[model samples]
Target: LNGFRRTPRPLIRAEYQHWAVYVGEGHVIHLAPPCDLMVALSFYFFLYNVRATVKKGKLYVVVGNNDYRINNILDEKYEPRPIQEIVQDAHGLLGKELPYSVLTRHCEHFVTELRYGKPQSCQVQLR
Candidate 1:
């Protein structure tokens, strides 16, 4: 926990954020980026797709929690996915390379894809 910090583009004032997927043990899977934060933030309109990787006990400084899916279960619009399949799908991606993108395939997209079977990000207009 000491060395593992939040891993994401530190755009605290920006509209987008990153979340890590805890894949059991002491490891976490997050997008490591094909480019740096300066490049992504300096050129806001440019498209970037990075490679997702598994980092053992590593995270960057990030804020906020994804409670909508976990706490919004009482909502009628919240359709929960099966935990067994989600876990299975998540584990299945442990050692594989994944396509990561800022707008199209972000950290939120990874979480949604694993838990809900569809990758979705709300921070950026996907279209």
Candidate 2:
């Protein structure tokens, strides 16, 4: 991840307009945007940092203003958490180069608070 430069340069903000969180059993989610989406792309930039690497299917996330949500399009009920919390959580989880134990402990504490309960089961395998 690159930080701001001393000299001024162009910045590219993601163009995706909406975000939603769905809790389910799938390892991947299909994103689709809404019809009358009229929000700033900045509002949903956190999706860029997630860095989901898919193997078999099309595995790239980009900024598009089409009707897309990252999880699933058919499922109806979904709620999105604040982007700030997601960013901070991802920073700690994704930045550290540590053993699984260390990461899982951090995830247990952090995820519990983030979800307001203990996770049924936790797994921390680096990809």
Candidate 3:
């Protein structure tokens, strides 16, 4: 399990607002407009700012909880192709060939290292 910190404040602010700071004149530094003291009192994690550099000509496909075909499964019409087939189709559409072994390795790392377990209060429901 990843050892992360949890602060007294919730993860998200009461309301979302972009913020900026400036320094000039005799004043030390200050923010302008849209600044509510109540909203700014909350704490958030810095790790949420992680960034990734994806190479051009490469594409990423994501399947979230919303993508699950549970109704199709119940109706007996559910048929899902293997991830390899999906990736191959994308490569064909792009008129290029990509490395399968490398992609599989990355997928494994994403599942095991990055998202090994669900977070608290996050659950998927199927009916």
**Cα RMSD (Å) per model?**
6.2, 17.4, 20.2
Kindly give the stretch of ten consecutive residues in candidate 3 with the minimal lDDT sum: 20-29
**Per-model TM-score on C-alpha atoms:** 0.58, 0.22, 0.17
The TM-score, computed over Cα atoms with residue i paired to residue i, of candidate 1 is 0.58
List pairs with backbone clashes in candidate 3.
none
Work out how many backbone clashes candidate 3 has.
0
Off by over 4 Å in 3: 1-77, 95-127
Ordered by lDDT, highest first, the candidates read 1, 2, 3
Best by TM-score: 1
Cα-lDDT of candidate 1: 0.49
Between candidates 2 and 3, the one scoring higher on TM-score is 2
lDDT score of residue 7 within candidate 1: 27
The residue pairs in collision within model 1 are 5-59, 5-60, 6-59, 6-60, 7-60
Query: What does the lDDT come to for candidate 2?
Result: 0.26
Superposed Cα deviation of residue 14, candidate 1 (Å): 2.1
Which pairs clash inside model 2? 31-69, 32-67, 32-68, 32-69, 33-67, 33-68, 34-67
